[model samples]
Target chain A: MSGTFNDVIQIIYLAAASCFILGLHLMNNPATARRGNQVSIAGMIAAILATGAIVIHDGLITTTGWIVLLAGIGVGSGLGLYTARTVKMTAMPQLVSVFNAVGGGAAALVGIRDYSTLGSHVAAATSVTTLLDVIIGSVTFSGSVIAAGKLQGIITTAPVTFPGARIVNMLLAAVTLGFGGYMIASPSLAALGVVIAAALVFGVSMVMPIGGADMPVVISLLNAFTGTAVAMAGFVIHNTGLIIAGALVGASGGILTKLMADAMNRSIGNIMIGGFGSGDTAAAIAGPAGAGVQSIAADDAAIQLAYAAKVIIVPGYGLAAAQAQHEVAALADLLEARGVDVSYAIHPVAGRMPGHMNVLLAEANVPYPLLKEMDEVNPEFARTDVALVIGANDVTNPAARRPGTAISGMPILDVDQAKSIIVIKRSMGHGYAGIDNELYANPKTSMFFADAKKGLAELTASVKTLVG
Target chain B: MTLLTDFIIFVLSLWVGFEVISKVPATLHTPLMSAANSIHGIVLAGAILIAASANSLIGYILAFLAAAFAAMNVVGGYVVTGRMLKMFKRRTVPASAQAPAVNAGQNGGKSA
Candidate 1:
């Protein structure tokens, strides 16, 4: 391509990058978030078109290369569009995981191809970046697949571990980095191949032992890995656009990971270690506080809900699993008809991912303003007349406030403080944390035993029957 | 000097990303993530460039795969993020007025 044309392309890329930054900025608020996304798409389209123009103007592409390149774009776009359109809001987390896999794999390939072509002519900077790219990208690719598999139940959601799991993780880490170091010095294909293989295994081992509840943090971390790998790929290819976009995602994703982990009161280092058996110790330390629980019938629970001046509903993944979001919304509608101030208290890590419960509720046409974050909603619980918990367990557990429990230090919705509590549950099974929820045993708490959908439906009917 | 400029750009961009994205509320984490995912699809440009110079069999194969992956990352990423954000919009803005910023009502209605 000519110098003028390349300069124009670079300018175009600069404008697109600005769009991305501004788009993200606009995402800071719900009002402008959609506009932010559109702005970003405009930038991406410009960048893609500019790149395509470059390829055509360069006139060096073989006929076969063009066919493969164009066909690949067409196929990938078709799949991406199809998957994105068809995926349910509840399944967005895993879909994001799969997309992370694709992005990571693609970034790693960029590094791999560049290194293969370089042979021994690789500069120190390029070699280091390529090695880093391959390691991080391959890890994200394989790790995300395992995450998606776990979510979809293709792999066990239970923390899978062997006796030497930590030791194996250490060995995999050692091999990946040790071989990666050698490749940086020698620049050989075999060493690079070994590094990729080791990293892939490490990704699998690292994720398998992580309990399903911690997936939001893991997914955010992998999203960062995807960005970092692409940035490294940018270094290998000397592309400024790649570096900027990659670095932005890398840093922002890192911040989001920290924010979510902090919200759950989990340490990043602990999550990254993801070693097994901590639950046993935490369980032992916490001891048994749950007993003498009270069970309430649908009519009784509905009585409390119908007559309460203020009610706060706490939902979790169980609610989504039961597809009871709509039912809950209907129940709330009935409560509101009786002059109850019904709103939702959404714990950050309530569902499998951050904002998951909110998305599900919104999809059910729950008013956005009626939904509130933990900080904003916690104090309101003290003034609440009824705390109706449907299918949510760990996030509302009073035990989280005390030390030594599996979920100690975690921030929970203050449902225990409400004057009366009605819990809708299928059974007395332990929550995802494997610790019995302490709130259940509270004198004011009553477990209304039924599936969230069934229980909520019955409550809605009961409220209509009793109050109508 | 060129390398120095690239490094500077990378550092500044990282700072910019952190500053912008840190302000996003937890309610929009999923959309913010998918949006950022689309941004990194700049790798599609790199893949396209490589495809242009690809000569041998192995080069062509690598370019093809990278292009496919990058294309998916670019196209699907924007589309999904847009869908989720559209749902958010339905609530944030009153149902009376739709924002003109995203007029692709055909595509936006899928996930909404």
Candidate 2:
């Protein structure tokens, strides 16, 4: 290849990286986020094309290699497109976790192939990157798959722990790092293999003990790992495009992870050590604990909503589980018709992922402006005539206000401040933290025990039929 | 490129990313995350380049898997992220006369 042509190819990679950065910049606002995705798609296409050009120019590939490459592309793109088209909005987080699995898995393979092909003949610097690449990539791969499985109900959403789980986790880390160090010093094929094996197991173990409620943080952390692994692969193969793109994602995922953990008022380390309650509510209700609770009928709840000057709806994972975004949105629409001000209060970690509740609501044709974030919507709860909490538990629990409790220090929706609070829940079943929601017992609150889908639908109906 | 050059590039990109992403609103977190997930799919390029030089049986197998996985990540990540971002729209509610019709005759509320 001519020097200028090679430089041009390099320039294409740079342009592609710039597009990714620009795309992320545009994503800060909702209106431009879609366009941002488009710009990113363009960047990916250009980068892929340039890579194809490089392969053709090098002409090192055999006929078998070409066949393998084409076949991979065909199968991969077809599967990807199929999932992207068919996935339910509720399963978006799982799909992203699956994507992380593949990205991390692929990056690990790159490092593995490079190491085995070169062996001890490789430079120490390159070997260091490859070891790091293989470790992070392999761990991200298996961990993300577990995360996806948990989210998809294939694996239990509850924390899965064993005796000395922490000790076992420590042992795995030691093996992975120890083997990685050995591989760097001597650059042995066996050492690299051990690192890969240990890291894969480490990944699975790392995510296994995590409860479902912490998925938002876990997924983001795994995503950051995936990016860092890709960057290591970039360093291994000396690709500037991979380095820039990987670093950008790594940093962004890091920030998002911090945001999610903060939303739950848990340290990242505390969340990662596992044994926090699972993501779903599975605890049996303590029958006697229901004392002093005010349970409202559909008409009563609807009357409160219909007469309210302002209604704030707080939605959580159960709302998504019951597929009630549309129901809730329709309820809001009905109340708005009667001159009631209605908006959704979205907790950052409300669902399985950050900002996931907003997406679910948006799919139901709820306007973007009506989905207010925690800090922005909390103060408004005071002026709200009725705070209708649909399937939300932890985020609205008043227990988060005080220290020593599981959710203490977690910022909760000020639903308790509303003139009237109605909780739409299945029962007094505990939520993700396995603790009772103190908000349900608040003097201003009433429990409307029902499935979120049916409850929201009923509330909307009652508002239409019973409200004057 | 030298290790130092690569580190420089990585650090600079991280800084650029932090500056851009630091102030993102809560509502865009999911889309932002999905987008960032897709961006790292640039590893697809490295996977393809490796396949270009693969010679042995093991090499071909690894290359095949890498390329396939990377392509899946790139295509799947972007497509899903796009599908999500597309939903973050501001839809104008219909006239109030039609609102009641949307929720009429819904089932009674309360746990069975």
Candidate 3:
């Protein structure tokens, strides 16, 4: 390659990196987030184009190779387009998990292919990265798949465990590490295969114990793993673009995971145990303590909402399951028009993923300022006239305030602090934590049984007639 | 490139990434994760390199699969993120300005 061409390629890569940085900076603010996404897309296009130029100039690809490349592009782009276009907001977590699996699996394949092709001679540095890539990437691949399955309910949303689950998990990790060390020392394809197999099993064991409630943290952790694997793949290929991009993702994901764990007040260690109570209310209600649940009609609930001076709506996975974001938004609008102060209290881990409620609410065209985080909204719940919970369960449970419970020490919305609480739920079902929500049993709280979508629409209709 | 140089670049990039992402508001966390997911699609470059050099059938197959996965990460990530962000428009944006901007972006996106 000519010197100028090589320099040009490097310059374009540097330009792409800068764009990524600028794009992320812009994404920090909601007003500029769309532009940030556009900028990142531009960066991606530039990087791809530059790489293509390099490949063509070098005459590096054969006819068959080009065919393979095009075929891959076709398959990948088709799947991407379909999923991105058609996936519902509630299924976003599952989709993200699937994407993580693909990304991690691909990175692992890159390392494995390169390592296998390198016959007897293997440099220490290269071997290290190759082994790391295969181990981390394979783990991420399988772990993410399991996480997606659990989120989608293909696998039980409740934590799955056996008598010696922790011991088994430790054994799998040890074997994977042992294989990784052996592969690094011998640089043999056979040893590498063992490493990959063990790592994949280890990934499954690691995530299988975690229940549905902890998926956001698990997904974020897997996101970080995917990044590290990509960075290792970068080392294998000697590509700066991969290294920078991968490292960025790794660092960002790691921070986000920690932040999420902190928000729950449960260390990542505790959540990983996978049995944070059955996360089902049936198990919870069947336990030693039982309390009567007061039921209310939609009209009565609407009466409280319409007459209230301040209303705080708490939405959870139930609200998302029934696709009632629009209805809830409508209900809020109706209440606000009747001179009630309506705002949302979004728990950090409300839905399957982080910011799940925010995305759904944003979709309903809810004004951004009306949505408040747990910390910001908790204090206001005291002054609230009514705390209306829609399909929310564990997050609003008063049991979280006491020890010896599944969600003990976990931060909850101060819904119990409100003067009156109206809960809209399908039934007295256990939440993801499989414990009975003490909030439902509180004398001040009344349960209005209905699906989230139907219940919200009914509430909205009732509010309209009562106030106007 | 020397491994030392690469290590330096990797460490520096990690810091840059951490600093940039920390300030992102909670509301945009999903889109942030999605965008980062798209950025890591640079693995496609590595996949391409492998495919170009592959001589055997297994090599070609692995490289092709890797490329496909990487492409999916890139395309699906960016598109879904865009879709999510599309829903986050400020309620304050005047209807007239918003419509034309979206139309122009759609056309620009196709051509670009």
Candidate 4:
């Protein structure tokens, strides 16, 4: 413990921590994000080396223990790599949810291990801490898995509302809290088992009521839960690093969840209990009012866009599904060539996740300068000549800002203020939020019923023909 | 036996690391990296628990080092992620825009 080697380890740990900070800083943009990852990895290497040194210095772990630890690390790293490589872009959200669950599960396991080690000799305070960690961590893990399943489409994305759904959830939560109390008082294996089961049920009930449209907010909220659980586990284990990291995640996730909820003009409580935006209910409510939408062809839409002096493009999940980013970029190029100023308007909650639109557009090699956030582009929409909506619906819906709608008071892209509107969609189906887009029925709007990619291709072809 | 296993584990870990590194898209690199920083918390927790239980000087030193390093990772990782996201907010083209030119070349014609 007093050797020169320990000094080296300490220095390495410091270096690693610095690298992590630097890596995270670089991660905010596409250009340096990869470099940030690399830097952070370098820091991780240093930390691992330091850990190994410290473990060796302690001389507590046997040879068998070391072997098992190494093997576990190897297997875990391999699985992480395999999943990262093979998962598709569409599945990224689910994968993230699962990863968050894993973190929570690991913390819970640590608490369990600590409890078993202490057994009947454990102090009352330690017992309570362990009980809390187990309860929170188990709930986070199970709930996160369910959320992942929903996002991955392995389970239904709609609210699985049944008779007495809210009542059942409330009862389950009450039971879970009771089990936690029992565990704290007795600290028996049976009590722990009951607590775990109750926690699992609570997680499911918490997430099952949420609909797909509110997934972004749901995911963020669940992430916050996972972080808090991890932090509680850290407190039980007396680990400062875990506590700090968990607190950071918990705080950030909580803020993001609130922001997403605000974007939909809903409260987090309503999202959880009311289950307001489920697909069927939302469609039934929002669809009837906007039944007067008019449709048009791709050629006519192309002509409208071509002659416009300025155009704003709004993208959504449909654009992602069709993989139409590149084609949209091509159409934008054509418009710009004709002396039409083209800009992309991005909503914060535009796609499945935050910054989703930026990722899709970046893949198409769209210039970063042309992509404008909601705040930056909303004001410009009033002066715009045209707003070409590509597979976007809810974000541009006037109902978000208009009264008497579910999404009332939520800010939108202001695309309705444009002199003309061309909406490209596959059908009159509502968006994930289950809301009808009033932009479709506007007098200035012309609906083009086609896949975003196909429509953009046709538009590009028509523009070429017209110019030639 | 432990040494042999450790060597094997180290090699396997490196292989997995390479795979993850290669697989992450340019766009996701930031958020994924930031998320990965959470691993530091686990290490720090382990170190601290060991130290607290054992109450040894060596354990305390090791725990402190672990905690400090992990904290650094969290702060630094977020800073980088924030900067990268801000790049998307820029009114100028990202330096990464060179990808389009390469694709245009491959298609044998400049678009627009």
Which regions in candidate 1 have their CA more than 4 angstroms from the true location?
A275-290, B89-112
Q: Which of the predicted structures, 1 or 4, would earn the higher DockQ when compared with the native?
A: 1
- Candidate 2 segments whose C-alpha is farther than 4 A from its true place: A286-289, B93-112
Q: lDDT tens digits, residues A257-368, model 4?
A: 7666777777888888745655422242322134577777767777788888989998877787688888998888789878999999887676665555676676565776
> For this target, which candidate reaches the highest TM-score against the unseen true structure?
2
DockQ of every model listed?
A: 0.42, 0.37, 0.41, 0.06
Please, what are the lDDT tens digits per residue for candidate 2 over residues A278-353?
6575765654247678888999899988988998988988899999989998899889989999999999888888
Better of 1 and 4 by TM-score: 1
What's the distance in Å from true for residue A28, model 2?
1.2
Which 10 consecutive positions of candidate 2 chain A have the poorest summed lDDT?
A: A280-289
Candidate 3 lDDT over A12-53, as tens digits, reads 888988988888887766667888999998988999888888
Q: Would you list the rank order by TM-score, best first?
A: 2, 1, 3, 4
Q: What digit string (tens of lDDT, one per residue) describes model 1 on residues A1-468?
A: 578998998899899899999998888777688888889989988888888888888788889989989988998899899988999988888988888888888999888888888878767876888888889989999999999998777887767877988899999999999998899788898998899999999999989988777888888899999999888888877788889999999986798788778877878888876653232112322322346988889888888888889999988777998889989989887787778898898888877766788778877877666888888899998899899888778889889888899888888889999999988877777776777888889899998888789889999999899989
Shift in Å, residue B45, candidate 4: 6.1
Sorted into a CAPRI-style docking class, model 2 comes out as acceptable
- The Cα error of candidate 2 at residue B24, in Å, is 2.2
User: Model 2 Cα displacement at A169 (Å)?
Assistant: 1.5
List of clashing residue pairs for candidate 2: A212-A279, A213-A279
Candidate 4 deviant stretches above 4 angstroms: A1-22, A26-32, A279-292, A337-339, A432-436, B1-112
Q: Rate the local accuracy (lDDT) of all candidates.
A: 0.83, 0.86, 0.85, 0.63
